[model samples]
Target: MQKILITCEHGGREIPEKYGPYFQAHQPLLETHRGWDIGALELYKKLVAAGADASFFSETSRLLVELNRSLHHPNLFSDITRQTAEVEREAILEAHYHPYRKQVENAIQTFISQKHSVLHLSVHSFTPELNGEIRNADIGLLYDPQRNTEKEFCARWKQEFEKLDTGLKVRFNYPYRGTADGFTTHLRKLFPDEKYGGIELEVNQKFPQGDKKNWEKVQQIIMQSFYAAVK
Candidate 1:
């Protein structure tokens, strides 16, 4: 049996209360798409309530230290905190970054050792429009094309979504590429295709950022699609 592990990296826009003073001037940025994934957390909650085996999240805003980005990644820190002294940055890594990654890595190893392949679904949300370009997908299932498991899973997942809501625009890879630098990609190096399948579920912010009724509707559709696909 495969076990599902759900994670929402940029779930909250909260700057730790201790770090609040450092982010006072950057309040506006904290609420933008740059701060946290707009609706990823809510979707994550829905997934958990729907029976995901495990779920993890960071309540701290991504602006402090991006959870998705690698430590050496250029955009790991937002403009506001990037210039902080090395000591402070290291503190953030110790307090926030390392622990999350370690916990996830350990969890995957434990599961795989128990004879169950692990499916990691990292939930995220993207802005409807970036720069002047309008994003064209309602939902995007990102996975490495080179991995047969990833490729086949996404294709069936997209078909499941179509079955649930035929009008929904489910894109293969959009807003961002799956193979690009990120947490799941990082895990691919550590876990093989047979033991681990990592996928990032990117939902356009338009759903949860829009009307409450429609957002609830979409969430239902997502769970229904999951059940259908698994069947």
Candidate 2:
């Protein structure tokens, strides 16, 4: 049996009460793309409603501690939190990071133990334009190039997207490489390809940042195309 697991790491820009002090002057930054993936939570919710076997999300602002990044990654703790005492940083990880990751890991382990193949979709959004360059794709399906299963599935998904709407450009590993330091990359190390297939679904922020009606339409198309792909 194949099971789907959905995760949205940067779903919201909520600063914890204790850490709110650090972000008092940085509210503007928190509202920006750097703080959270703007439309990721809504998209993830849509996926959950589409009958994912399991789903997990974190609303804690990435600026406090990047949930998608590994502990050792330099960007794990943003500028504000990085300046904290070493013990404080450890406490933050213990409270926010470990629990969320452990929960998802345990869920995947359970599914794998049942001899079920798991397809983990880590949902995220990228700014429409970065560094003055416009990203060329509307949706990006990222997976490790070396993993044939991941590669093949992405190719199929892209084709499905095209069938749904050729106008909606879909690309492979565009905004960011799948092998980079991320939660899905960490899970890939723990779970073998035969058992776990991890793909990061990247949507262009333009849709959510634009007209509400168009955003809703695109989201519905995404859900439909995804269901078609998995089948």
Candidate 3:
């Protein structure tokens, strides 16, 4: 059997009370793409409600500690938190980062033990334009091309999404590499390819940043297309 698991690492831009002081001077940065994936949580919620086997999300601002990034990754701590004391940084990781990733890891382990192949979808959003370059795809399906299961699933998902009349662009591994140092990449090492399929579903911020109704419609189309691909 195949099971679906959803996660949204950069769901919200909420700064914890203890960490508020560190981010006070950088409030504007937190409001930008550096803070969080704006519409990711909303789309994640829709997927969960549409019947994902399990789901997890961190609303804490990535500026505090990026949940999507691995611990040793240089970008795990944003510029603001990087200046904090080492002990305090460890405390932040203990309180926020480790717990969320551990929970998802545990969940995947449990499902694999039950003889199920897990399709782990990590939802994220990208700025429509980054570093003076405009992103061409409306949706990016990221998966390690070397992993056949992950690659095939993304291909099918993209095909299904493109069939919709929504006119949204869908591409594989844009804006960022699927094999990059991220939560999904880390998990791929812990589980065999046959047992785990990790894909990062990246949506362009333009959709959610625009009119509300159209955003909701986009969400519906995404959810519907996923079901079709899964079938």
Tell me, by TM-score, which candidate is best: 2
lDDT score, candidate 3, position 80: 88
Q: Which parts of model 2 are misplaced by more than 4 Å?
A: none
For all the candidates, what are their Cα RMSDs to the real structure?
Answer: 1.0, 0.8, 0.9
- Please report how far candidate 2 places residue 48 from its true position, in Å: 0.6
Better of 2 and 3 by TM-score: 2
> Where does candidate 2 have its weakest 10-residue lDDT segment?
156-165
- lDDT value for candidate 3? 0.92
Point out where model 3 deviates above 4 Å.
Answer: none
Local error of candidate 2 at residue 15 (angstroms): 0.4
How well is each residue in 19-131 modelled by candidate 1, as lDDT tens digits?
A: 88888888998999999999888888988788787778887899999989998899988787788998988999999999998899889999999998888889999999999
TM-score of model 3 (CA atoms): 0.98
- Report, for every candidate in turn, its global Cα lDDT versus the true structure: 0.88, 0.93, 0.92
Quote the positional error of residue 215 for candidate 3 in Å. Answer: 1.1
The alpha-carbon lDDT assigned to residue 21 of candidate 2 equals 91
Pairs in steric clash, model 3: none
The number of the candidate with the highest lDDT is 2
lDDT by residue for model 3 (19-122), tens: 88887788899899989998999999999899899999999999999898888899999888999999999999999999999999999999999999999999
